[model samples]
Structure formats: C-alpha cells, structure tokens
Target chain A: MRATTIHAPRDIRLSTVPDPTITAPTDAIVRVLAACICGSDLWPYRGENPIDEGVTIGHEAVGVVEEVGAEVTSFRAGDFVIVPFDHCDNTCPHCLAGVQSACDHLGFTTSGQAELTRVNQAEGSLVKTEGTIDDALLPSLLALSDVMATGWHAAVAAGVRQGGTAVVVGDGAVGLCGVIAAHELGAERIIAMSRHADRQALAREFGATEVVAERDDAGVAAVLELTGGVGADAVLECVGTDQAIRTAFEVARPGSTVGFVGVPHGVELPVRHMFRRNIGLAGGMAPVRRYLPDLLDRVLDGRIDPGRVFDLTLPLDEVAEGYRAMDERRAIKVLLRP
Target chain B: MRATTIHAPRDIRLSTVPDPTITAPTDAIVRVLAACICGSDLWPYRGENPIDEGVTIGHEAVGVVEEVGAEVTSFRAGDFVIVPFDHCDNTCPHCLAGVQSACDHLGFTTSGQAELTRVNQAEGSLVKTEGTIDDALLPSLLALSDVMATGWHAAVAAGVRQGGTAVVVGDGAVGLCGVIAAHELGAERIIAMSRHADRQALAREFGATEVVAERDDAGVAAVLELTGGVGADAVLECVGTDQAIRTAFEVARPGSTVGFVGVPHGVELPVRHMFRRNIGLAGGMAPVRRYLPDLLDRVLDGRIDPGRVFDLTLPLDEVAEGYRAMDERRAIKVLLRP
Candidate 1:
C-alpha cells in the first residue's frame, strides 16, 4: 500500500507503506475510495504542530469496509461508508450528550493517509450510506467525512438562526462550506472574508450575501458596516490565527456568539472584552460524527455540493503534488482518488 | 444631601453634597434607604481602578422615589423601588432581548455613595415594590438591586439545568448568592470555592452541596474529581481575576457552559484549550432590571434571604467605616443606612 507520510516540515511524500489489518475486536479495515487534505493537516505540514517521523497525514475519507473484527456488528464486508475523523464508542456519556468529539473511548486512526486504513470503534465512527454512491457524488459525499460536518458544526456552535447574520472569517474549504451550512440553517445574510477571487466567487455561489476583501481590523470593520454597525449575529472563526480570532471578537455584536472551528494557533481571547460585551464563545474540534448524517442527506438531495471546494483532484499516487498545490495556496482543497 | 465621595484611593469621606434633581426628562430622584459596598467597588478603592475625583461610588440601592421628571411614568413620588446599578431604557431592542445592561440608552447614575441619587431612564430602571416594604424586608429587596440579580444572571447565562452539577468560583457575596440562584434553578449539586468559614457557611446555607478550599488548578482538579472526572455541568465565575476565569474553564465539562458575572479586573482566556474542550462562555454585567421583579417576589415571599450577605450594618454617617470594613475583608458586604 502507498500512503502520504510526513518526515519533516514541508516534507510530505507518497511512499510505499505496509497495509493495515483489523487489530481490535471493534476495528474494521477500510479501503479508502477518496481522501482530501484538511485545514488541520496544514498544521503539521507547515511545522506549526509537532509531528512524529513518518506519520500518516489525512483524516477525511469515504471507503468500503473490506474486513471487520469480531465485535463489529453494524458494518459488514463491502459496505460503503463515510468515516468521521475521530473514532468514538457511541455509548459514552459524552457521545450520548451529542458531543462525540469528547467520547470517552475516543481515538484518532489515520494510517499515513493510505489506500487501506483501520477504523477503530467502527460501529460508532462509520455511517453507512443507503447504497453504493454514484461516482459523481463520491467527492461530495467524501466531504461529509470531515470538512462538511466541521462547517456545519461551526454554524451550529455559533447558534446560527433563520434570519440571522453570519460572518465567516476564512476562505478555506471549511470556511466556504460554513457559508453553505449557515445558509442552510437560514441565515439571512452570509458574509465571507476572502482575498482570492476564486474562493470569493465560490463563497457567493454557496450563499454568501457579501464578501469583505480586507483582513484583520479592516475585515471586521467591513462586517460591522454591513451589519449597520451592530456587527454579525454570529461570527464563525474558521481560521485559527490570532488575527482571525481577534476579528471574530471585533465583528460580533453584544450578546452575539463567535463559533470558532479552526484549530486555534496562538489565539488568546481578551477576556475582559468578551465578558463586557456578553459575547458567547464555543467551538473546538468539530464533532463531525454528530453532524455527518444531516450533511450527507443534504449532499444526497443535491441541496449542496461541498466538493466544489476541491479545486484540484489527482490520483492517490500524486498525493505529493496535491500537498504541494495546497501548501503553496494554489488550491483551497485537494481531492485524491485511490 | 449627604453622600459618600471617594476623592482618591482610601480617601472616602461622608459630607454634605447638593441634592440630586431630575437631570433628564426620564430621570427620577430617589432618597436612598440603604446602599451597600460592592465587591466591584473594592477594585477602585484598592487602586486597581482609578478613582475619579469626587466620584459617587455606590451602585446598589433601594430607595423611595422622591421626585419624577415629566416623562417618568412608571415611577413617582413615594414609590419604594429597587434601582438597578445600570440605568437602561427597557424599550430598546437589546433590552427587549433581556440584555438591559447593554441597553441602547444605557446610563450610570451614582455620585460616589449618595443619600439622594438620580436614576436615569427611571421608567425602566426602577422596579417598584407591590407595596411599602417593612424594615425587615428592606435588605433583601436591596439585594435584588445588584448582587442577587448578578448571581441569577450567572446561573441563567451558564444554562444550569435541573439536576446539573454547578461549580462556582469566588466566595464574595455575589458568588454566595450564585449558590442560591443555582439551587433555585434546580441544580442538584453546587460546589462553592471558599476558604473563609463565614462564606463557606453562607454558601452551605444557600445550598452549596460541597465547599472546596482551593484555588486554580487544585480547585479544578477537586471539582473534576467530585464529578467523577467529567467536570461540572455548569460553572459560575463570580470573580473576575485571571485565576478564577481559568478555573471556570478547567472545571467545565465539554458541552457545558461557564457563566461569568464578575466585573473583570484582569483575565485572559486560553483560546486553544477552550477551542479543544468545546466549553461555552457567556456572561457580563447583570441585567438587574430584567430579574428584579421575579427576584423581588422571591424575597417578598420569604423564599430566599439574599441580604444575609451583609454581615455588618452602619449609619449613613459611618459610610467611611462601611468602606473600611469591606476593604479590610472583615465583612463580605456592608450595609449603610440613611
């Protein structure tokens, strides 16, 4: 089997690797059909996060269940499914509370971004589609594995409501998809902050009512102006940079919420400001497993096409090129077929 | 009229001052029956916040409406009322949303500590009691003016549910009252952090199930241990210090909320940790006007005695001593009578 491995900063490569087998009673072997690079992947790839040598790099995919361990009951051989990034035992207290991200027996399983990977807690982690998905819908369905669910979580965490104003603070695939989720949640106005013409256009197509071309304070100012100086009813912080987080605070009205989905990097909240303004903040790693079902339904119903975020696609063998394109900012997200 | 004026740090003086008159069309003059030293007042008295020359300091009071401006309809001469610390026009959009603290026409009306003060937006800011309150009920009704309402807001903002476990960080009057509020809100267990015997007893009397005599990390660990390592379902931060804020974050379970009502002194939120934990933070200055009616009813019916927080009482002429008692930490709160 071949997998994308990261040896050092900016050193991601597709290399031949040993295939994974069912190692636990609850584990299942999945033959990856498609996978993509997530914004979080950039953390280790850009050396912003500490990485172990030769570690597998991706956590987004849709696949077929090739084999299952003795304890796996809900899934069987050849079942088409979407695997959420985090594996969880569905019966945990946190899982029962709908916060699967904090599942008691949670674990991450990514075998070097390989064609075949092992999924732990298979019954709770994988959501099987009704039938074999159409080839044309695979990319979009594959997105439900992480990005789409993550974007949906951002909207849900922000308490986005019908007729509410939602401002998304990033132009990456997740941010763009957040625009879609906010719209689907009935946000009357969706504001996307983007400098790239392509991403900006896609955001508008995805239901962004306006686009602010500036960054940081200027971007926040633009959002406030659009909101008639009251700021956004909900601001989605999809980019975890300090500037983006600060903008999230600056562009939210008093008593409004800022849902942050981006993996925070050097983001410190000015607590005094947040407290005085009565701004609510809630977001972490998206509990993708919690949102995958509804998002998959939206994709299957043709109500959304989140795969449009994948401006570039390539064979699994060309995973290095895909990484390069995303690393150099040439692609918002890359889709790889095995 | 005699008023307590803080000309500088530790320089509080009780002296004759001009009587307050209607300053706005919506203003009403009140002859204060009681005014108390608040925990927030200690911030300026201790030189943490700069004191303006000749500034009138007290914000919490229950008084008799002595005069009303032409536009003041809800309040008139001889009406006994609880005046919220913040003067808000309850008709604004924000006020209608129950965030009167952030009212569009918000104003503050305290002259250092005064016997006679003018309340702006009197029609909305003053909650008149159903009838003249007996002397025994005066203190409890006055508690509704600030501390009790603040505690109630903390519980409400944190979304404390029936049978939920709550952790309150702070042992001030507001924090003690938060214990009562959480109990009234149906919280099954309330953990109050307090080392002082007086406060701990008060907290226990107010329904705190357990008292933790620790601060910061150790306090959080204790709370987590008490909850079987899952942390509290709701955390109320009644102290605005950095340590209190951090403890609130650490002791809240994923998907739970932290309601903070402390007048923030110096605090910073670890965005990365908060993001990863999915903890929700919501709070600000209490919208006392919003809760006064119900809280006052609770007081009038003898369901709660929030005024027990005032362990010491003094005549208005001894206003300086009242400040000294609170500043020396000999009293949780002090009541000054005119």
Candidate 2:
C-alpha cells in the first residue's frame, strides 16, 4: 500500500507501506475510498508539532470494510462506512456521557491517507451507510469523518440556538463547515471572518449572513455593528493561534460562549477579561463519534453537502500536491481518491 | 450618619458620613438593620487591593426602606428588603437571560454598614420579604443579599445534579454557603476543603459528606479518593486565589463544569490541560439579583441557614473589631448590627 509520511517539518513523501490487518478482536481492516488533508495535519507538517520520521499523516476518510475480527458484530466485509477520527468503546462511562473523545479505551487509525487502514473498536467508531454511495458523494461522506463533525461540535458546544448570532473566526475548511453547521442548527445570522474569495464565497453559500474581511478589532467591530453592538451570541475559534483566541473573546457578548475546536498552539486565555465578561469557553478535540451518525444521515438525505470545502481534488498518488496547495493557501481543502 | 470606612490597610474606622438619599428615579434609601463582612473585603484590608481613604467597607445588608423614588413601583417606604450587592434593571436583555451581573445598566450599591445606604435600580435590586423578620432571622436574611446567592449561583453554574459528587474549594463564608447550596441542589456527596474546626463543623451541618484539610494537589487527591477515583461531578470555586482555581480544575471529572464565583485576582487558566481533559469552566460574579427570589424562599422556609457563616458579631461602632477578626482569621465572617 502507498501512504503519505511526515519525515520532518515541511517534509512529506509518498512511499510504500505495509497493508493494514485486523490486530484485535474488535478491529476491522478498511480499504480507503477517499482521504483528505486536515488543518491539524499542517501542525505537524509545519514542524510546530513534534513528529517522528515516517509517521502516518491523516485521520479522516471513508472506506470499505475488507476484513473484520470475530468480535465485530455490527459490521462485516463489503460495508461502506464513515470512520470517526477517534475510536472508542461505546459502552465506556465517558462515551455513554456523550464525550467519546475522552473514552477510556480510545485509539486512533492514523494511516487513513493510505489504501488500507485498521480501525479499533470497530462497532463504536464506524457508522455504516444504508447502501453504497456514488463516487460523486465520496468527498462529502469523507468529511463526516472529521471536519463536518468537528464543525457541528463547535456549534453545539457554543450553545448556538435558533435566532442566535454565530461568529466564525477562521476561514479554513472547518470554519466554512462551521458556517453550514451553525445554519443547520438554526443560527439566525452567521458571520464568517475571511479575506479569501473562494472560502468567503463558500461561506456565504453555506448560509453566512455576512463576511468581515478584516482581522482583529475591525473584524469584531464589524460583527458588533451587524449584531446591533451586542456582539455574537456564539463564536467558534477554529484557528488555534493566540490572535484568533483573543479575537474570539473580543467578538463575543458579555454572557456569550466561545467554542474553540482548533488545537491550541501557544494560546493563553486572558483569565481576568474572561471572568469579568462572564464568557464561557467550552471546546476541545471534537467527539466526532457522537455526531457522525446524525451528520451522515444529513449527508445521505441531501440536506447538506459539506464537500463544498474541497476546492481541489486529486488521486491518492498526488497527495503531495494536495498538501502543498493547502500549505500555500491555494486551496481551502483538498479531496483525494484512493 | 455614622458609617464604617477603611482608612488604610487593616485600619477600619467608625465616622460620620453624609446620609444617603434617593438620587435617581429608580433609587431608594434604606436604613440598615444588619451588614456582614465578606472574604472579598479582606483583599483591600490586607492591602492586596488598593483602597481610597475613608471608603465605606461593606456591600451585604438587610434593611427597611426609608424612601423610594417616584419611579420605583415595586418598593416603597417602610418595607423590609434584602439589597443585592449589585443593582440591575430586571428588564434588560442580560437580566432577562438570567445574567443579572452583566445587566446593561449594572451598578454597585454602597456598603450598607452605615446609617443609611442608597440602592440603585430599586425596583429590581430590592427583594421585599413577606414581613419584617424577627431578630434571630436577621443575620440569615442579610446573607441572601450576597454570600448565599453567590453560593447558589456557583452550584447552579457547575451543574450540580442529584446523587452527584461536588467539591468546594475555599473555606470562607461563600465556600461554606456553597456546601449548603450543593446539598439543597441534591448533590449526594459534598467534599469541603477546610482546616478550621468551626467552618468544618458548619460544613458538616450544611451537608458536606467529607472535609479535607489540605490545599491543591493534596486536596484534589483527597476528593478523588472520596469519589472512588472518579473526580467530583461538579466543583464550586469560591476562592479567587491561583491555588484554589487550579484545585477546582484538578478535582473535576471530564465533561463536568467548574463554577467559579470568586473575583479572579491574578488567576491564570491551564489551557492545555483543560482542553485535553474536556473540562468546562463557566462562572463570574454571582447574578445575585437572579437568585434572590428563590434563595430567599429557601431561607424563609428553613431549608437552609446560610447565616451560620458569620462566626463573629459586633455592634456598628465596633466595626474595626469585625475587620480585625476576619483579617486575622479569627472568624470566617463577621456580622455587624447598627
């Protein structure tokens, strides 16, 4: 099997890797149908995060089951499914509480950007579709593995409600999807802060009522103006930079919430301001396992097409070009067929 | 009129000040029956917070309305009432959303440790009791003004649930009151971190299932052990110190919330640990105005006696002793009668 491996900072290569096989009673081997580069992938790719030589590069994908262990009861070979990034036992205390990301026996299948990957806790981590999905719908189904579920978690964690105003701080793929999630969750007004035309266009198409090209104070001012000076009822911080985190605080109303799904990179909360304003901050790695089922249903029903985030697509062998395009800001997100 | 004023660090003096009078259409003048010293007051008395010379020193009180402005429709002269520390207009958007502390026109009332004090937004700030309370109930009723309401808000914000375990950080009046609040909110087990015998006894009486006489790591370990290795379901942080804040985070389980009612003073959040653990932090100044009605009902019905936090009693003329006792740790809280 061929896979994308991160050897070091700004260093990625397509190379041959051993095919995956069932390693546990609850494990299932999946033949990857589609995989894509994630913003979080950029973290280790940029050397901002530590990475070992030849480490597997991606975690989001749609795949077909090739083999299943004896204990796998809910799925078998030939099933098309969406695999959540985090693998958890559905019966664990944390998973039962709807926080699958913190499941006691959680595992991950990092070789997602390859021809085959092994999924642990198969019954809990993979959600099977009713029937085989067409090739055209692959990108959108693949999104359900991470980005879409993440956007949904961001909106839900921020307590976005009907008639509420939602402000998204990043223009990345997840941020654009957050606009869609907020709209689906009934946010009356969606504000996307983006200067890129392509991402902004998708944001508007996904139901962003307004787009502020400015960053920092001007951006917050624009949002406040749109909200009658009350600021947004909920703000999603999709970029983990310090500036984005601070902007998230500045653009939120006194008692509003800031749901931050971005992996933090040198971000520090201004405790005094947060306390004084009574703003609530609730976010972390998305428990995609908890939302994958509903999101998959929406995608299958034609209610939403989150795949619009993929501005570029290519075959798995061209994964290097996909990473380069995203890193150079030429593409919002790139979809890859294996 | 005579009032208690802070002349400098550790120096509280009784002196004559101008009598308060209704100054706004929504204002009311009250003759104070009782006022108490809160742990927060120690910040200025101990020089941790700067104080202007001769500034009045108390903000919690019960009194009889001396006069009401023309626009004050719900309150009138001769009515007995509890005045929340902060004044708010109940009709504002924030107030309507149950966040009275962030009300659009929020303002603080003068310390009612004087002969007369002015209450702003009188219609919303003053909660009139059914009748004048007897002498024995005065201290408890006065508590409804701040400490008791704050405790209730802390527990409520932390999402205390039936049969849940709750950990309270801080042994001050508010922390003790939080134990009472958690019990009333149906927390099956309440662990109070306190070393003072008197406060510990009060905690036990308020339904604390256990008391740990340690701080930080030791305290968190004790709480976890008490909960059988699972951290408390909710944690109420009533102490604004950095150590107390950290302890609250260390003692809460994943997906549980820490309700912090303490006025933060140089406290910083551990963002990385918080995110990875999926813990939620939500709290600010207690919206006393929002909880007064319900808490007052509880006090009136004898469901809880929050006034027990006051371990020392003194006349208004002995205001210096009240401050000295609290500052020297001789009393958890001090009550003063005019």
Interface RMSD of 2: 1.3
Which 10 successive residues of model 2 chain B have the least lDDT summed?
B270-279
Q: What share of the true interface contacts does candidate 1 keep?
A: 0.65
Look at candidate 2 and tell me the lDDT of residue B20.
77
- Give chain A TM for each model in order: 0.98, 0.98
| Per-prediction TM-score | 0.96, 0.96
lDDT of 1 by residue, A1-338 (tens): 88889999888888888888878899999999999888788888889999999888888888899999999999999999888888888888788777888888887758626798888889888899876679999889888888888888899989899999999999999999899999999999999999999999999999999999998778877888888877888989898888888889899887888898888888777677787678888878888788888888888899999989989998988888888899889999999987
* Per-residue lDDT of candidate 2, residues B74-154 (tens digit): 888889999999889888877887888887878786667777888988898789987658888888998988999988888
- Cα lDDT of model 1 by residue, B24-135, tens digit: 7999988898888899988888889988888777888888999999998877799998889888999986787788888888877585257888898999898887676799
DockQ of predictions, in order shown: 0.70, 0.66
In candidate 2, list every pair of residues with a backbone clash: none
Best by DockQ: 1
